[model samples]
Target: MMKKPGSWRQIVWLLIFTLLWGTTPAVGGLFSSLSTEKERELGEEFFLELNNNYPICTDPFVSSYINRLGHKLEAQLPPHPFKYRFYVLDDPSMNAFAVPGGYVFMNSGFIRLMDKEGELAGVLAHEISHIYARHMARMLDESKPVSIATLVGSLAAVLLGGPAAAALLVGSQAAGQAAMLKYSRDHEQEADDLGFKWLQKAGYDPRDMILAFKKLNKQRWYAGGQPPIYLSTHPHTDTRLVELANRLNMHADVLPKDHDNQEFQYFALKVDSLSGSPYQLLRRMTQAAIHEPNNPAYLYGKALALAKMDHPDEAMGALEQGLKLDPGNYFIRREMAIQYFERNRYQQALSLFQRLAQTQPHDETVLYYLGRIYQEQRQFADALSAMERVQSLNPAFVEVYQNLGTLYGEEGQLGLAHYYLGLHSLTSRALPTALFHFRKALVNLPLNDPHYARVKDQIARLEKMKVKVN
Candidate 1:
């Protein structure tokens, strides 16, 4: 069972934010008719708070997958004001939520619960619709003047399974919270309609959303001893599901349903493996493997669960058995190579990754892992070469930035090192650290370098956030 949050927690958060911002959140006014700029600014502050307080999943592959899938759906929509960013929250809550500025977060547990890529797409599409519709701003516009701190406290309360939101629902503030809830429900319906259209438009099955809702609403928290936070935030109603099902008749004859996605297994397994409670995951995957003896994903998931549980040798044993079953499985092979590296069996890892890289030169995972192996062996030149290649292949590979910074620093390239480190911090949303490193980069980088200009632009943005270089 989840612990109910005390009133003090909400009060503390409200007090802290009030002190930081020097006023209560004029929730109704500040965002009432919030311009795009103001919404973005608000989102920036909230996201910064979230990043500082929550544990964001940092697995390069997992992070990249969520962003890729999110942006893929985002591209289906017409041009928008904000650049969409997706993050995986490192929590076991079966919940997903969107912040104002085109930022959507999928909890690791939520992502793990999803069985199909289309289902995941459905979830993303819904969140995307919410952002595109500016529902938060609209809700504020509709609400009676409420403090921003009250909104934050309410959110904090909901997160804690506390009473602030429930408390607000029935008092002098009842009308405001009641109105907010009504809007929330209405917004969910609108998002479902829009998300259905967009998901189908983006070549995913519209029915996936219905399936996802039923699947989630019917589920108990798999980690056990935890409440269904998804229900608290996004209660999937029978009526809502019925309406969605009936609405599907309108698009009955749409051609060529796009339902299959090869990436789902790897993506789901990755999230499940990194879950907070690996013991539960291990047992789950182990039973799954027993049922489907040849399912590579289950075997792979089981090994990863073991690895996460600190049973490296057992994980290696499981992987070796899995590899024997399916020698050609790329996911399994890549994982085996990763295990080798983790255990300091660098030669084996290097050999395996090199061969994998030969076949997959454009694969960021293979290239990134190869680069790390090379860096570990003191092959600085090779490491830099591989890391640089990875960067050229996918500049958004955030881990590559940090590794490149380390490699370049080892090569005595301080300017490039600082620049890459700055890039890493910037992407990680560590504004102060980003500002510090970007300033250091400016001192050492030539004025004419393209990176110098990039660094300056980023520094200016950070400064706008009150993050000074000095």
Candidate 2:
């Protein structure tokens, strides 16, 4: 039997948050002694490790929307040294976390739970506050010296989750755990206070912060004693709720009542469609479409769920219906093109993708699909051009390097092929494999070849990285 969305989220949350509880002590002062530059360097290292281990949501629309929202909240803050980057992890847990420096992550399930844009903005603002106030560094400054091996082992256990987390906390002292819990609670309170202030400054109602907490609090009841990790780390107390209400009352005359935001609604639907069981999502979206017969968003969501369930014909029909309601909907068009591609309707897919490329020039997903279509049709040059654009727009897209390598290899450019394959391996964190490819590229290319120098430099960098890891 399929797990209900609520149950699924609870289980996933338990696994992910267990890491936070188990590893908090080790993380406390891990980066406190480092300079700002060193802190950022460590953050980059953490980000890379996560990308290698976890499934990060690379959907262009989802990532861009979340980043834009994060930056809007960030704009209301005073100048800070670190550059902020927002990411949506592919996990279905109801939690968000901020690491040292300015890296913030939100789970896909958590985004789906939000009803208003301000609720999400409030969450992001709270995370930003943790980074802005240097809470991690401060906490670490007061912590005792812990072995580096123990710290690494604890973090790995958390990331591994499930049975590993249980084993990690098997012998943890109760006093140490209690102290870490108190420390976490204190940080949560400070984040909430500062986040509320920033949310108001950014022209979002401060009450939305209260609403966000209320929603999480309600989830705690649904989960009984095993509440989601967000609640565990940031306990929702009566006093906290009362304080937030009082703060909002002070600005009641100036604050506007929360209303539905179309962007939030659309993105929430998208996240839900992407994360939930296909059959269940299709059932839910089907009912939603029937109730609001003219709503394109519902139809679009239904189309995606249908596609997920391997009902291509039904998915295409739904997209066509949605297009009739909103012909200019970029999302609907993109879905239609994807469906066409899946059905081997090459010309139809190519036509739609080309049109979309003209309108959404910087849309990485659009360009990526366009490249795929071109590749399938044996238009290697066009495919290479499209992929190059995608690479320039988002280097974090690991697939572009893979595709580029394949295309170059097909075109009899062995040196270039090896070089790109090396890059693909590097981005995927297969350092030794990447070094091998880089070496092969250098061996194949003539000494005077322009790329020979580049490949040599890459080889040197990878070797240094391997040394540092050792």
Candidate 3:
């Protein structure tokens, strides 16, 4: 039958999906709404699961660029309860999707396919409109409540390739499946209309929205898996293309001026270079470099690809060349600093990260690196402070937890050390280990301690779960 859940990651997603699906009930009147708070809660949980199970891009420079662009368009809309979030998935499928409560995901493959920032802006705008309209919530409320099981099962089936899901998929009605949940033509039209208007207001050409769909219709570069995931989930692209064309013509008088996006080209190249098979990526970046030997973006791509292939020295040379071309490019500098750290050039790495921290005072990635550098230098206090800041800024950053655990243990802070180890265990899905560490932390932490409550919560959560701890 279907291949049994292909990887541990996929199996974890299946469990998460099933567990989360049970929490939100469709109990109100038909088409009645989910409270903004409930939708936000669900979206947050969903995003966290995606982070744990999927290949999400965590590159600070790229993450910052997408959020800035997504929020720029979001500002044109009237007030809503959402603090909109955008994420880039390290997937090769030419797709993007919006979930409830202002969460939108962009595929790296889709971003790489875009010709310019306008196209990406258009795509983000459309997804934003869908969230603003609460299309998914509405769909949930309108579906036959019983049919929702099929929907969950089908989506979970994508993650769990086991016989149970395979059998479930075989009998599931086409209408009850997740694919059927793709926005209908009317929903697509509404998003298109609102998206284009917002795109124009955001100083991007509305016509690029149409161009985005056209490109999707022609996209063939992907290695031919089941068709692009975008067209499946965001169906009716071919029909929407014609409609978007006429709609653009009708509003030609008020189109916004074409703004040049200096950041997009570099961002796109980074995604392409970082999110591909390393060997093939190196070849593509190298060929591009041959044609435009002085292009820093291409140089950056080559350097990154070379690093991925474990050619550290070659990577360093490419980064040096990139720095000479554009000495002020912070991303290249960031990479060079990372290279230095990996090669144990700790002094050079520390100097570079210190400069980065000054510019990006709250960047967790920069702070994380500083913490690591400090740890290597045996500056325990400094390492703890830097990593503590990172944990405060983004608790989901798994790398910091283990380091914090070690640093705290080294400094003889038994309570905090075990507490952080508990968190690290949680991230790794080691439930019994997490429970063990949390218990140890609680026993050692005094009630007056700042981390006491947090430790209690972690213990309570693990104890509540039906898990066996050896």
Candidate 4:
């Protein structure tokens, strides 16, 4: 069972971040934003941490399927300031958490526990409620002084006096770390109630919350020695089950109808069909399709299985059938575009993305890919235009910055190239790319160079910062 977080472990994490950031408040602020760039950096870091710290079973098809579900849920969510992104942690522990902003994380164990779509949707909606309600931000606000001080002090000590001071700084914060996780039982109940509502509004059965709890309760007895962590975070399962049942009964007339069992099965098949060894996946997918030829998701799964098996022609045909059945599915269109792009059919990919972007103007991904297609066609001007629009829409998208940098460098706009490359450092890939361009630009960068000098300093500072891996 999951208890309160360990004081010593929390201290170690705080000190690690402190040493990494060198106690610079400015740098701390830089990493603290709710933007996509910050989220990606934090997401990748947290993803790596959870994997290293926990047990997980990896399956690509399952991962993609969960993400697809998350995307659909996100689209249905009411507007919020933060960008919600979901990640499946490769951990067997049945636990989930929402970080600052809209990062909803789930372990593979949670995925394995999901027997029906509503159960999965219930979990997702629960996590999303935490995010929408700013639970993480509240946690941070309540815990920040200690957390940030420990973080800064550790880093400052490390930078000034090296490893010994860093160790001491970290050890100091180990005393009060448990205070961070003291969320009241009321907070848990509130999140649960709102989560149930969210699921209902999203066309899921409100009763799934109780069903999910029932599943966990059964697992607790069946697994004897070690009940899942999910049991720990979500306390009083029986009480919650009763509460959900009562609510469903009271609101029966207003509630969404029960979900389709066949639909849930189709959803599960989408993951199972593409998740294992390519040959195994292909065999399962083909057999499944033969048994359920009319299911669009099954056809799509077979396409994914074919793709994994390296049978592109077969995959293309399968994808066509799937698309014919579900024309409005952006995921299908996006995958089809990817296939065409891989085959050097730029025009076809461009056409599809263009239509998608027209309806989804704020979709930076579509815009980014559109820019890529233009660039591949040597339409630098058009490429620049598309990328520029994306930059305006989401400046934190470092890939767009990187693309712009490359275009500028190729076109001999050294000043522009340096600036763009420098901004690209804001992305999660804190690598040599930024420094490489900085060095190249230094030759042409005047002491008073507008873009080069400013960008160079940011790059230099970031280069000095270190990252601590958990």
Candidate 5:
């Protein structure tokens, strides 16, 4: 059986993970004094901490799909001050949350829970509403001052499901906690109202919001046989459901439009393959493939599960079958290239990636693969070029930083090697280590070097952030 959500082992893991990453001073709550700039900075800091501590799903297909969906919803919203970002957290809990700024995260579990694209849209729309309406800021405005340590401790306790932790944190601030809960309920209602409007405006069915809520409500009943964290925070009630139903009735004339079901199926299967155990996922995909013999997605997912289980030959066979079914499928071709690269078929992998690159010029994953193939082939110049393109396209691609550092070190460019290594460390959220590398790069670099100022600035910024985090 799958491990229950909020299991003790999971809680312990989360507690340890949060502690290791340290804590950021909670920003938007009773701390209404924070300015817009400060809120953005705090959000960035929290993002870094999460990147360091949490298992962020970096699968290229998954990331690209969510971002595309999120941006579509974002386009329908009015202008906002903060730049929005969407991320998938590798957690198997049906939950989603928005930070003080425009940082939104959806758990892989939640993504799997969604039955349709519009259901996913409804979740994103609701979270986006939270950010746009400045709900956190207003909540902070209404509450009394709470220390950062106390707030983090409370959060940790919540994650661990420790009643003692809750009692310890809330005993003195019982009235404040009550008020905050009430305000949070209000925030949920407002988000639902605004989210319904945005989803409809974005050309998605408003009825899907009710679907999403019902799914969560059902999950809450069996979520470790306790209330889910989402319900604890969002608080689903009959009143909320009635409100959603009434809105849908009012907009009953707006007929729901069709979406690309094939694309949705592929994305959903990918999520399932990534989240479930390899053997279980393989069995499920095999059954799916048997039922839908012509569907390439099930074959592709089976191939992925096979690969995860270290059955490369079986994986390749599944991929070949998938390719035969849908020769022009991008995902199948991409998986074939990856499998080829793993088996050291560099030329074949290179040809496939290069072909894909023509259409996806800005895809960092493709560029990274191209760079890796070149590096393995000992084509130093080509490797440098490919990795540089990746850097320019997405600075957050941490693998490129390590590869560049290795490439420069091989060429005996110590300063550039240390510089890129510093960047890799920075992206990995090892601030002190990053600062050390940046300082070393600066020491080796010439005073008149063009890169000198940039290295110095990085070192200074890391130092400041280190102080704040510690």
Candidate 6:
């Protein structure tokens, strides 16, 4: 009656969903069906899961900067009322994908190759173009049954190979889907044209777009022994490069003048600071940069590289030094906050988080962490308030509901407790979380515990259901 969880039908739908949501676009064309709300929601959930699980790379600065860049590009895109969000995955793969709805994933490897803001803007703009054109929806239309097929194949791949091996095959299968969705040669050309146009709109170098592609092409070839899966998803490197060149030739005189990105120096420095290497090695890199004091970017990079391998006390000192030189450096503050959070100094972390919240009041991440700190301190009221803000900002945050349910259960508010607990049950996979909160309620309530009896029964039933599913 419950569909027996992970039944053949569920497996079939999962595969269909994965394929429908997994592949990249063909030439840059738009489809009408993506305009629908249900498809958009499904696409959003799929992408959010993909990103949460298999991020692109590991540097915080790159992830944050790309998300900023994405928002800027999204603001400049053609108006169609739908939720659009951009994220940089913590991966080193040199590729980008636009999922159903407007979710975009850019890899860190893409960010590392970027020298100018325009190149980064170009990449984001191209992905945005796919969303505006509804290219993913069109691809889904053509590959309808492929979703079911790909999903089944993916499940088989997973069952046969385990999750890790399944990931490898999934990437390849996704590339195959991308090849099939290839926008018309013309759509591809238009995307290049429009993407560069937006890069100029965003006040970045148009040529960087061309250069980024060339660098990717070279990287592909240089990776002789290992063929990068990224190349598999991308259009022909030579073709893309030529198209960019031809566009630049046509608009050579009219193109915006090359712009210098002061932020790029900060971005690069922030990334280098987080790399894993010996302190001596980092000190040497910093020493070389210190010798060339005229180059502020190099100086910043050296400071970051040093801080990465230095002790926490030393790292804080180095961060302060860099901040002294560049007083308005937001990245330094963010990085410092990260260091504090990592070191388990929640009091200091709370202070930094509060500061960031003032600037980014609606940031779910800031609220989530702020709430976490309060929870750690046993300030349940404050924790609930903070988490409530996050839930309001992004209602899809299932964990926030779980946390709120837990807080309510602890406070003996059974009505509020069960409401949030039921909300958590609808969205979360961790049975223990719900079970723990419900059990807390059971213990605290009246000995008669009418609500306790109901919850106890529900918990038992759910546990039995889980056992069957397993």
Q: Top TM-score: which candidate number?
A: 5
How far is each candidate from the true structure, as Cα RMSD in Å? 5.5, 6.2, 5.6, 8.8, 5.1, 9.2
lDDT of each: 0.71, 0.70, 0.73, 0.60, 0.71, 0.59
Instruction: Give the clash count for model 5.
Output: 1
Candidates 3 and 6: which is better by lDDT? 3
- State how far residue 88 of model 6 sits from its true place (Å): 2.6
**Model 5 lowest lDDT segment of ten:** 20-29
Residue-by-residue lDDT tens digits, candidate 5, 325-424: 8888887888788889988999999999999989788776687789999999888878888888876654433456888988888777788888999887
Clashing pairs in 5: 29-140
Model 5 CA deviation exceeding 4 Å by range = 1-32, 144-183, 362-364, 378-420, 438-470
Using lDDT as the measure, name the better of candidate 2 and candidate 3. Answer: 3
Per-candidate total of colliding backbone pairs: 2, 2, 0, 2, 1, 14
> Which residue pairs collide, candidate 4?
18-155, 56-90
Predicted structure 3, TM vs. truth: 0.77
For candidate 3, what is the lDDT?
0.73
Model 6 is weakest, by summed lDDT over 10 consecutive residues, at: 23-32
Which is the leading candidate under lDDT? 3
lDDT at position 391, candidate 4 = 69
**What TM-score quantifies how close candidate 4 is to the native fold?**
0.63
Better model by lDDT: candidate 4 vs candidate 6? 4
Per residue, candidate 2 scores C-alpha lDDT tens digits across 1-470 of: 11122233443343244344432111323333556764565456556555655667766556666877888888888888987888877666677777666888888777877888999998899989988887755654455544222333333334333333455445543223324422266677788788988888888988777787788777767777576666555664556888778877787888866654876877777677676777777788878877888889888888878887888898999889999999898888987987898799989998998899899888877888888888887888888888888777655455578899887887778888899998887766677777888888898888998989889877775665442322
lDDT of 1 by residue, 1-470 (tens): 11122244454554355433534212324334556876665565455445444556666667667877888898888779997778877666567777667778788777777878988999999989988998866665566655444444343334423333344334333334434532357778888888888888888888888888877776653436344665555554567799898899877888346666656787778777675567887888878877899877777888888888789998988888888888888878888988898888999998998888888776777777788888888999998998897777544345578898889999998889999999777656566788898888989999898889878876776665566544
TM-score of each: 0.79, 0.77, 0.77, 0.63, 0.80, 0.67
Count clashing pairs, candidate 1. Answer: 2
Model 3 spans > 4 angstroms off: 1-33, 75-77, 144-168, 171-180, 220-227, 247-260, 359-364, 378-381, 384-427, 432-470
